[model samples]
Target: MTDSSRPTRIKVIRKSMKASPDQTESLLWGDCLFCTDAAMTDYDWVLVYDEFPRTPVGTIRNETEPLLCPPDQTILITVEPPSIKIYSRAYTSQFGTVLTTHSIRDLPHPGHTLGRGCLEWLYIKPMQEILDQKEFPKTKMLSTICSAKQHTHTMHKKRYDLTRYLADRLPELDWFGHGIREIENKTVAMDDYKYHLCVENHLEPHHWTEKLSDAFVAMTLPFYAGDPLATECFPQESFIPIPLDNPQKALEIIRKAMEDGEYEKRLPAIREARRLVLEKYNMFAQTAAVIHNHRETGTIRPGAMLKGRHVLRKNPLHALRELTDTLAYKIRSRGRRGTGTGA
Candidate 1:
């Protein structure tokens, strides 16, 4: 068939087959529909899942398409990795076209290279009223529940213990956990604290964990430790990033700020920072815009392609080698040489 005439396949997650007694037969279908770009074109759209369908009973190839799918009823593409080679052979022989491959990480359109989703919640309310109360302390520190994958058990224990230690050292200070419940409370608690510590575990290139966003959502000043690109993702003045080489100094500054109440008058500016996030990164609106753009354009553009050609021309290999040598030199120099974090 000509490319234009070829059938388009949209991949959707299958739901349970057991009909619900409360609904009409037509309405009783069990499937969660999260729209994907798979069926927008004549090209086959594959839904690759790490887990088996909870309701369907069959090998990936034998699975039947659900009656509730879009009217087009294009082919259902499924593959189990590790055994992906077998599925690949079956797909090529049966469909006469190679299945387009994409990683799950590739799903969320690469938002602004500034990393639009880097902040947790777009809106954080001002806590100035709460901070004005005599009972509420002016000093506070914020951190999140450490994920096991991101930190060693020992590191998690140390950080948690350190939180308690800081709390004990400053009885007037409050310690907030990184939970959905706590994030909800940030609208109030953030007003009282002078500093929010975004102590992330990993430091990957161009990858800053969601903790930075958590801090932003709280509408408090952030003392951060993450990828240097963290600053690129948000306005530079929005955060006070802790240099990897001068962690101790960063901590000291936070301690002093809390002790002296330097952050009290700065609350207005902090609230302004939070407002900027809401204006730029409304999640629902952004998601809808992405979906609409993909539908209109047919294909979502890759994020890496957004970088300037001059940036691509730079020698990453040489930079890596230089970075490795610099790291070695720092390790060897130890306390003797002054070191700084790179942006």
Candidate 2:
């Protein structure tokens, strides 16, 4: 039996995900040590952050490998949205169980789709330090950060277009991200804003990303879009939803929220949501809870496993279709960039 007082050692398989402090042994949850070192052998459990296609196993970016541990001792978690089938479908042959996070407000479970997890896992330790304070003075009224990404997904295209529209009109808004004026960290800019324009790349049930979480951590109310199911996981009053279809109406809401002191009115709910993000929704905290549950139960049955080699496996026709779509998107994106109208 494992000792009750000792901190559990969890070997995290990054699978070419972003680098973080945990990649080299970091302490968290008061009793958990997470490390991404592939050579480490003395670990109680194996957790795989399965973000595939975009971040496939091995250096070549197309191959995959089996879980380091036996099925029972392994846990696979994917944070991508269901729209990205390539990411969701990658590395399926390696593990029997995968925990999906989109549906759960408190704990992760096996589900049909993968939604977003803490995309800010790389900076959670420092984010927690910033949130530890009780008050943050809002020097600015609103801001937003969006990357100039060209995606084949329709929702992604819409989001990028909307971001361009907002940036042009909202002069008071401090807009910055990839391909814009680069900021070293999101928290620094977020800390000074009263409200943040937090929109998702796609709109699906229970889908949300770090855009919302960053606002909450910095105690800035989010003028949020996407994720109709967000209220189920967070306080309803925590965010003001705007419709992407109507740019004028979205602007009106932002203007009214700022003029009417919406941040002050919603401060209570924002605090609650911030606590949820820090204590319950952060990736490290969620992983720690899973470890605790596994220790208490002393057993975790394997879920589903695919047979044969862990390679990029898909129907030839479907792959061809996707390839064609990507080429079309790239061509259109080039034209938009030439016209100075693309994100």
Candidate 3:
């Protein structure tokens, strides 16, 4: 490598938003993404999400490995949730920091084509709903499932009322998903549904996840409640956007779409969306794009985005209590094993 053309080493880091006060490379998610990793490292960016911060930002340079980039020379990239602070100033003061965000709302996001068997089941709710939009059902729309154990939002009562109304007045749309059902194949099951009720857990910008992507991959229109700026993520015509605030209006749109055979009409656009999503907007693709953008701009665009509270992880006491309970249980179990119950 020539003196002028030596690849700039960019080190990516992740901070535990609600827990750790400092940014470490503990890979929570979406950490390992390669921009240009061929024989020659063109982009020369390293995604160190899961790795144990082995190459921290403030390591002292040794004379033996002078070819290795110094911590200060490398740009420290922090991948964090959009709801939390993008980067910390105290950390950036030591090393150049870049911010990256992910659209992955659910873990191990629903991917793969829906199998022919899952024709009846329209949706999957493995995790509990935080701030969800009302399930807008149509005449023939059935075989839906959700797994929201609880709704913690202040307006949860209103949504519960709506569900009650549907149960009494219209029995068809009253199906609610609760608890976990490990279907044999998610793709096979989800593929059969016409729409996936993909109401996000939150309403903030850039806080999107695979709920929308899962629907697209399965060739089903996502009755989306999250991501108001859907146009920016993918083609607007691809998914059926729903009104988050107005239940009646959202239901009307869903009902009209079902009655008018809108899904069939939107098939062409939906196909295009699937292509775009897999090729460009999928989690890996998006991470690659963020890396490329950062390299081209020589920094995070418009600089660091700092400080925002996560709606779900707002309380620290809960985490502390959980940790305490886990420790206590382990200790008690060990003591019992040492003592011996009878024999």
lDDT of each: 0.38, 0.63, 0.41
Q: For residues 1-343, write the lDDT of model 2, one tens digit per residue.
A: 4566877777666645433335455545668887665455566676667533244323213433333344555656766644443222334324434566433322223423243454544223454465568877888888888777757544556667777887788888888788876878776568788988987765656567777887788888999887778898789999999987788889889888888999999999999998888777766776666656553333433442322213433656545644554454446445432112232
Best by lDDT: 2
> Which 10-residue window of candidate 2 scores lowest in summed lDDT?
334-343
Best by TM-score: 2
| Winner of 1 and 3 under lDDT | 3
| Pairs of residues clashing in candidate 1 | 10-39, 119-213, 120-213
Query: For model 2, what is the alpha-carbon lDDT of residue 209?
Result: 74
Superior candidate under TM-score, 1 versus 2: 2
What is the clash tally of candidate 1? 3
The lowest-lDDT stretch of 10 consecutive residues in candidate 1 is 24-33
- Candidate 2 RMSD to the correct structure: 7.1
Give TM per candidate: 0.44, 0.75, 0.49
Q: Write model 3 residue lDDT over 1-343, tens digit each, in one string.
A: 2133433333332221122224322221233323221111232343333112222223211101111322322333333322222222222333322323332221111211111111112234321230132232333442233443334332233334433433344333424344434454455435556665665544444545555666666676667766566677677778887765567776777777767877778878777776665556543444444444442333322322221212112447644543454354335434332111110
Q: Which candidate, 1 or 2, has the higher lDDT? A: 2
Give candidate 1's error at residue 209 in angstroms.
Answer: 4.1
TM-score of 2: 0.75
Cα shift from native, residue 238, model 3 (Å): 1.6
